[model samples]
Target chain A: MKIAVLIAPAVHPVSGRPCAGEADLAALALAQRLSSQVDVWYAGAADDAALADYLARGATHIHTLALAAGREVLSPLAEALQDYALVLCGARAGGGDGSGLLPYQLAEQLGRALLPDVLDLSKSDQQWQALQALPKGVRRTLAAKLPLVASVHARAASAVGWSYARLQQGKIQRKAATGAALPQVVLEPARRARALVAASKVSGHARMQGAIAGGEGKSAGIVVKQGDSVEKAQVVLDYLRQHQLVDF
Target chain B: MDFSTQAIPRIDPRRPWVLGPSGLKRIVLGDDSGSRDAALLAHGPAHKPLRSSGPFSQRLLVVAHAERGQLDDAAREAIAAAAILAGKDGEVLALLYGMQDAAPEALAELAVDRALTVADPGYAPEQKLALLQQLLQQESPHTVLFADRSEDADLGRRLACRARLSVVTDVVEIAADGVRRRQPGAGFSLRERAQVLLLARGVAEAKLPFVGKGERLQTAALPAISEQVQDLGSAASPASQLALEEADLIVSAGNGVSNVPGFLALAEALGAAVGASRVAVDDGRFSRDKQVGATGKTVQASAYIALGISGAVQHLQGIKSCRHVIAVNLDAAAPMIKRADLSIIDDCQSFISAFEALVRRERNLV
Candidate 1:
């Protein structure tokens, strides 16, 4: 089965600093874990160098969708995903529109079943079984037919190991793609309300010394060192009180 | 064709039962029931001063799922602290849920003007939200308070949005018309407003106290409704999955814990459940169920060992209630280090390996 991976680059405010999004890395890692026949798609602001790197890693094809600033457009990408059997995206983007609502909105737009926060995915009998993370380390399994959207949460799987051999033989192709019309919402630039008034610096020596003292004090477990039972009990009470363990 | 002419039942818009200002009630929404009850007892009665002060006659609502666990002393202290803050201007009412008989004890311990028990079968998130929403709408409370990490955060957000009110999340300090949030970010500074407020835990204004005693209510006599609703079931599902109140030990990891090499071994060695930070789960390092944070799960283990976590405000809010926090990190400056009972500034991998080795050696010696 062919898989399409969606990626958006992270953008920094003020300095306009550029960084690869953690979500992209997560999606790429998942794509690598699937069968080698998978293809990759890049949406919004991915430079050629990053595209080449993804190609080197095993992406069969890279599709780039050009978007202007402040577009807040997503429907075009959702439309482009129509051809793919299974669409994979990050549960949340790290920077620039990292609302964590994109996947749900996209799924709704596409009218496809969305399995979110999926930890493990396996394919059997033309359907995919997903192990979803519930609260408190409990997991629930869900099954969806092919051509569904899976927005994988960051902790869904281990990072895929990179290999030099795969990098050497991998093919890279770039395709120019058009997205659906940009949504008509006007976005006001984020305004800064406060400025740093003062900054304090602590000497490294003082920090190190403090760390040493803290380490020593912490290593001595169960502060009741006295052999006398009453004294030990008093020490325990003192310890609890010092730590604010009990409410009076 | 004439359907529009059907007379709507005459609803009394200003019925005295609805217009009379309900006593200012405070609810300690927390994961810990025992602590919540203690807090109600400690500070619930003192809130009577608000009636004399005027403009603060709203009631307090404490909502939490009972099946999750009993509130401990620390949670009670937090509630007491909130009660003290709420009492500065209004009458306090306490609502306690969870366990078979928490209502009467809560009613007795708290200076509750009236006690309402939302029985077990009716224990769903939507039901709780709907019931609270109905109460708040009817009472028109000046403020609604909730523990920062409780499942009620979602409810608080929805209520605030629906009611067109501003909510102050993760509040550590609260005063007359002013609130201080706990962390650095947007809306961290003290907000001054007489408008209806929803205060979350960890705000900078008040120090959460730790209590030692909790009241156990009589469950048999409390009013109950048994009709099950599916929406409420989903909302309460997340809280019910946690066994933290009963856990003796918990081993939690964060995004910094990249691989799965040591998790199983640590869980086996410590006989503890494995937990993860929201960042860790978002990075695909673990499942969402393992996540512990504001948007995740709350744990009250006796011993909590944190591995490679920086302890962001959201994550810290959930685990701060744990009895002991043992933090292992390479960075001594990580927030978790400051909060930890035992802070180890060493490689987490080495510590995990050493812990496993020590456990194995001890087992062999036995």
Candidate 2:
């Protein structure tokens, strides 16, 4: 069985700088878990080096389906997924396309079962057992036949231990697929009306000073004392309250 | 970006394919209003009972995890209201799980055609899923409506996948043939058609009448189903560090509340449970479980104090069960002020300090 894991590199919203978040790590973890049975394929919008990192972990091959400049399209990637026995993607991309609708749209187009926000998965005799999270920690398990699409949530896969030797020895080769024609949709200009207004007001000297002071206080290091249960509990509660950790 | 020339698969316009079996089965997931105090702050005084506006042409199934203590009367009323709404056109089957004991007669009074009681025997997620899937398969629902949250979304998606049907999430509006999903892009709503419609939100703005003229339904004891899985003796143990349902007084903060950390002291001072708005939860200021909104826990408490919460419709829907509401926000135009019994148009932090001091002074005088 060839399991294709979809990958979308996380990008910084403000700087457009490429990075990785918990979702990428989660995909990598899930791919590693499934590597024992099926040949894992990593298909993503990343450069050769970045793709190699995933390949080193467990992927058999790396396929890069970069979005063309001036186009916000997902057709090329969706079409390429036709060959895989089971296609898995993150529920939502971290940056630019953060709506988490890619898997849904792809499933609709392909006319296949689309499982979004899958939390648990187990395979037996070519059948897949998946657990879904419901409201209030309630979960439901489902069985699906092979050749399905799963959009993994952040909590779907558990954290896997990484090996240094695997990272060093992994060879990542990029194979490009035939790109689909870009959809003809009118692109709207990016809106920054709120940010612009906030920026202008914060540009003043006194305001900047106050912000700097606040930032410093926010980042202050925590001090812990040994064997002080009451004080420790107080610290924890205070931290949670100050940081809005609790419900209130 | 464009659907104009995408060569979208052209289904026969005259003969549209309808998925799922031909059965009048409906799955109704009920949220316990007494589970969290934030529900009272989020939903306010206008306690709109859950009711079905459209024609209910299916086997009605109601599901809820039973609450601790004497079940809140208002919460039971809400569930009863939902049951009545669901039973408007079909037989109502209720599956109440995670309860200390079975109350079948009370459920029957609430118009339950059949009641399945699962004991609070500490079933794991996988175990619960298996049982739920089995139940769903045994009684297939044409429509499934669950609370719009992470767990429900997961279950709904998985169920849809297994049933070979389309699943839409974050649906804020529901109708007969389809649902209106709040799309990602700014304020856009998508109309989706499906055989099995999973509603995250039932018909918006529809008021359901309170059940039984506020009379308490008599409890009917029933034997628990014996389904041996793994040892469930320890499963009922409390997993969360905090139990919001047991809290009488709650102090909830929102986006407008500055110094999020300061609220802890206030909670401690007033002997109140702490809660938060959806904004704070999304901002990583609090856990999603602690969030009080339409998408979060429904809280019913004696006194719900709102700090900087503006009381949006979504937030209001979650906290409508609170008896006494106190809002402290700087925004005079905030909807919370209008809904609150005592609206203080002041900084939340300052209000907290004053309230704490006043409480302290009263205690000292006593």
Candidate 3:
């Protein structure tokens, strides 16, 4: 059975090198574990000299869909992923427009059943049984036939580190996407942190209003009045509910 | 203006989700006796009838699902946002699902007049999507609002796609013309049409000026969906301290907690488990399991003594559940000190020693 894993570019925290996202890498590992015939696909620019990180992990075949700019990846990826028996993606992007909307949108575009936040996946009686998570760590068992989408949760499986020798031998195949007719949009840079605002003069009421609107005040608890250390400790202990938290 | 002012989508009741189970099924959630009025009185009789014509004809539907019959924080937030956006003309209606007990009275206490319920629990995602689609088409609502939850966002996108309507997900603000969110790219922020919006939490949190005269409307019949998905049940999430979530008193340390051995002793003296801030956890001073912060674990301790922790906002979020925070840090201006009930400015080692001595003396006296 052919299963495909989708990957997005993520910058390594310390080294600041481009690599696949952690959860996405977990999906790749899961796909590789499920079967040997795993096709790794990415939908953005691949400019790095060593794009072999995915190859080093477990991707035997890597397909990079080259999208220059302005085009929605939804269409290009949907066209590229039509043949696979199963599709796997990280539940959501960890960062960079992390709206967590793409997996579901992609599922809709592909016309397949989507089982998101999948904790574990296994084949049983010719059907794929998925362990799905709901709000607050609730787990549900869902089964579906082949030709469906399953997103990998962060805890799906531990990722195996990449090997140097494998990185050298892994091959990545690039595919040029058929561009759409829509007018190209100008690419924008990432938003930087909010610009620092200069301190402004304010009157009494306005200053009070700013404090309330800015929400700088704590809503609960009283400040401990300055006093002797022992008395302060008593106040602290009084605040601590012994039945709830303190053993004494 | 992009809000649904056009034609309503078509609906077929025979959709794979609406049909009731063909076989006997266990009641997954909700109390049948309390819901005795729920099935029949879902559309409250005392409430004014919803308009199907004129400028005010369009209905405002706020969709929320409850766990154990109480709406989650996000759901309540969405309800508030929807109510605020509805203004005075449109009838604010709530589509509540997954009640495990009697029909909730909370919504009725809000400004909502009518509530549609599907007290059935454990329905599959596909079944939920289908039922919502039927309801949307049936109501032909002018505006629809849902919470920005994982399931709700997925279902909203799918429903939008099927109905050929525009959907705005993760909307932080709703205006007359468009909705706004964080800048998707650089230079300027992005906006979306206001037809269907999935509200992000923490924005709208006000109760209706008056309580909703809410009544339980009969939920649509839910047929069993694809059995491919099963509930494996829930397990407790792993936390830093085994008892951190249950602990009512916590003695936490941060980067300033240099003396690990002494700190542990002091915590033991206070009968408190050790919790570390993100700084300490990141510095390798404490294991990830002992980290206390938003990304790690949010403790609900009654008394949280934070030592040497210059509380970051993320750390503060983790300790928001903490009832009483006692901050001990050298920096008086640290954000944590402002939030703490007891703010002590002193050297970390000296303060811990003095506090420990005081605690020991108090114990000896006892």
Candidate 4:
């Protein structure tokens, strides 16, 4: 019954503090609830200051899979995580070329079953039951065997909030990458991306309303008509002193 | 960006893979477009992996195929976007996975020059990934587009990792040199010259232009791979009683909704279908089928009454086709307020009660 949590870092916009990512922290909380054999692991290099946040949250050991320079991350990280029985990751990351695909790719590489958007995790015997989150408030219970990867959602569990005392107690162990380099790998240039919306005055106008000459206008297309009858004729049901007659 | 109806691109084998005269550089590759012409029909060998012949030019490939046969909405958008980007110089190609028989001829409706249908019926995720890897090795496309799905992202990321290609997921806007996406609250990041771009879950699919060439081809089976996982049937129940996609009137709930019974009652009173926001769905208060958002089903309802929804961008994308919207919630600042024609700021449960009482009184008066 070993559980391992994957860690990614998030930089809060307002505070500029590097915190354990929201989704990852939720996953960590679930891992902590699962067993005492829980370890926090990061795939790439991170500032030690940020890694400290996980130690306080309940992770006893932190393993950093230091990707070799010029090596792709998938092979290296996948190879290193082969031994863990249950691996949990956040649904996505907030910063850096974060595509929210690492967890899925890792599962594919590890040849394990992936249960994504997991809101809760419980085990009985050798089987694991996952309360998975889909769109809306609907939840699905998925059962998978060990050597499984699940992506934890925000609603997974109560996260262990940050504490300075635990941060002082956590220790990090670094592991080197083991992937072999490929021949003739083309180097991709730095991606150039800009905000689609320009800086403008904060106005009361709505985005859907402004685009409305002929296209679907938020206000133009709807008719709110429907089944409209009530059984209020049952005056004896309430038996209340009628405010209109009795008060006088 | 005016394209001339008379401008027909000529293929120059000498100029790499660029389409001449149209000057649009990207080449879209599909599994097989029913192209009988020997040149367009013959792309490369069937079983052998391809090593690209030249430097990269603009090209877009749509990897379309889920467990089922029918193409998904995001896949359609990927094709639509590729068509718009193809213009005259670039080309649109579709890559279909599954067994040889799984590739259908219906792709003629799409605005693509050619499409490649690979024989891969089992619909294994890893097998599809391997086939794509082989095709990519031969073409070296400028940008690879995928329908934003959990598995699609996984496959795309695996390709990116193995190929060392720059990648961006959850993209919305398509630019000349690249694509851009807005980070919530934070401004936006643009990815230029990236090798791969994946559309966010809810990019509005574009309408097709007038005609298509209808060329197609079927390829060999994907490489063998061990399958380890089995998909369990959906969790909880199947979904809501009403199909939100077909419903004309939708009474949607959101996070602010407190009285679940009252909310359902409102929908029943109005004779509208029930819908919920992403958060409401995650709260286990509603069925996944009732969700209306980027990850959920889109509806083109005549009127939508939103209760307690905070109008995240993903949710807004789902309601784009909605005709008239009326929102009720306590916070006037929620994004849904701006999208609604009439917004009432109040507690939603109380509002429903008041409406119920008024409706009964109005019926009596009549």
TM per candidate comes to 0.45, 0.42, 0.63, 0.56
Number of the top DockQ candidate: 3
Tens digit of per-residue lDDT, candidate 1, span A1-248: 67778766555434444444555666667866876656566566556654454454445456776555445446667777888877787766655445444665565567676666666678767567776554344455666677677777676654444556656665545445555544232232323322111121334543354455454324444321224333332333344346543222
- Show the lowest summed lDDT stretch of 10 residues, model 3 chain B: B45-54
lDDT of 3 by residue, A1-248 (tens): 88889877665656656666777888888888888888888776555343567777766667888877545577888888999979999876543445566677777788787778787889899788888766433467777787888888866776678787777777778888854643322333433322212123333543454345443235343555466555555655655543233434
DockQ per candidate: 0.06, 0.03, 0.17, 0.10
Interface RMSD for every prediction, one decimal?
Answer: 13.9, 18.1, 13.9, 14.0
Q: What are the root-mean-square deviations of the candidates from the true structure over C-alphas?
A: 19.4, 20.7, 17.7, 16.3
Q: What is the lDDT of residue B315 in candidate 3?
A: 93
Error of 4 at A193 (Å): 7.2
lDDT at position A207, candidate 3: 44
Grade the docking of candidate 3.
incorrect
Of 1 and 3, the candidate ranking higher by lDDT = 3
Instruction: Point to the candidate with the largest TM-score.
Output: 3
CA lDDT scores, all candidates in order = 0.54, 0.52, 0.66, 0.64
The C-alpha stretches of model 3 lying farther than 4 A from their native spots are A11-18, A44-53, A94-98, A162-165, A179-248, B1-55, B100-105, B161-164, B175-177, B182-189, B206-210, B223-289, B294-316, B321-366
Question: In model 1, how large is the Cα lDDT of residue B81?
Answer: 42
**Lowest-scoring 10 consecutive residues by lDDT in candidate 3 chain A?**
A193-202
Q: Mind giving the per-residue lDDT tens digits that candidate 1 earns over B216-301?
A: 32233332333221221222122223455434457788756665667657566545677888877888877777788788888776
Residue A22 error, candidate 2, Å: 5.9
